[model samples]
Target: MIDMLVNLYELPDSSELYQRLEEQGIILRRANAYERHIVADWVGAHFSPKWVSEVKVAFSRQPITCFIATREKEVLGFACIETTAKGFYGPTGVGEDARGTGIGKALLFRSMEALKDNGYVYGVIGGVGPREFYQKTIGAIEIPNSDPGIYRDILPD
Candidate 1:
């Protein structure tokens, strides 16, 4: 549950991974504004309510900050950047049945590239779960004393 930092500029190119996903019929792209409700409902049922709320905010941004991997119109996975906080990469998840196809990596890299294009030198992955996955994928480094960094005051409804 530690926050991790990513050096956006240092990320390796993701085009190859993207192409692989494309070949497998998984399309990676920004989440459309009109698709927010469906995406949010999916997240709420599969992930968490907090993430669904944040994904809604991501859709509201002028330039949408959320990305998704879909196949034949079904949402396979999603990754959102700059949702909870500026320059923060998170709220990402892959469907249990749709994992191991490089979708998660594609989503992560795509979102990080977007942040880089937005001039972010570094991106924070707040309250991270898969530490090794982020580290192996994007060389993310742990931020000391960051457990519950921004979620310390989250109250139950």
Candidate 2:
């Protein structure tokens, strides 16, 4: 995987994406501090323990850097910014059943918007999985030689 860079100032308006999700009964918003355990557990079950750790860090922030997609009070997806590092967007995942519902894209936009609100001109999509998705969605450009960037070192599950 490689890291990608996004120009926060150039982010496309997300109203349409958000509205689309709304029509499907999906709600995207920042994770509340009180929901820390629930969200962390959800991430662990749906993604990874490593991501659960990052989710905890996101909850620690004053404004909570994590955003979640939910419907009928059920978690569909999640995105975290400034978790592993500042100006970094990641550790996100949508439940397998929730794929193709635009949850991921909406979460991405919400995270990017939060990064912009945090006074960052550029945001890094650290350790990208689907390179094409990032490139196509937010105009993210690949960072040369970024494979394993900040993801090095050995640790076991």
Candidate 3:
């Protein structure tokens, strides 16, 4: 197994990640759902603040985990991990520019490790990218998109 190492920064440490990200000119951040412009700009998508506002509210009701990635002291990527009631990794990302370079795998591994540490022995990647990456990089299984998510697990022996 390719266990990728990632430094888990608390919400406060997020500032450091943002600072580093700013230096690299990567404008990604773990903003609240109400912050749509920030996310739009980060994803290069034309979205309205209304979407951000709506999502923020939805996020509060659901299990949402967010994080930012920095390269050389600049924000390179941001991710949102929305967990299912059954404990799955959902809605993950490694910014467009930050794709490859093992960032996705690193992010996925870090998130899964964290989940595992928290007693979640399983995870799923939902509404994300590169299906092959999930399987090849972390040995995740590709279930039918019945739940429309990439479900993977580290079961307790």
TM-score (all chains, Cα) for each model: 0.97, 0.98, 0.52
Best-fitting candidate, scored by TM-score: 2
Q: Which is superior by TM-score, 1 or 3?
A: 1
Per-residue lDDT of model 1, residues 1-157, tens digit only: 7899999879998889988998999999998999999899988889988898899989999898889999999999999998888999889999999999999999989988998999999999999988999999999999999987987889674
Backbone N/Cα/C clashes per model: 0, 0, 6
The Cα local distance difference test for each model comes to 0.91, 0.94, 0.46
Summing lDDT over every window of 10 consecutive residues in candidate 1, give the lowest-scoring window: 148-157
- Write the residue-wise lDDT of candidate 2 on 1-157 in tens digits: 7999999999999999999999999999999999999999999998888999899999999999999999999999999999888899989999999999999999999999888988999999999999999999999999999989999894988
Cα error of candidate 2 at position 80, Å:
0.3
Model 3 pairs in collision: 20-73, 20-74, 21-74, 21-75, 24-74, 89-124
Candidate 2 whole-model C-alpha lDDT, 0 to 1: 0.94
lDDT for each residue of candidate 3 in 1-157, tens digit (9 for 90 to 100)? 2211222232112345435535645544344555434544553442334323333432464233544455555445544444343344534445565665455554555556556655665665554456666665566665554443233552342
So what's the TM-score on candidate 3? Answer: 0.52
Alpha-carbon RMSD of each model:
0.9, 0.7, 9.7
Worst 10 residues of 2 by lDDT: 147-156
Cα displacement (Å) at residue 134, model 1: 0.7
Question: What stretches of model 2 exceed 4 Å from their correct place?
Answer: none
Model 1 per-residue lDDT at 79: 92
TM-score of 1: 0.97
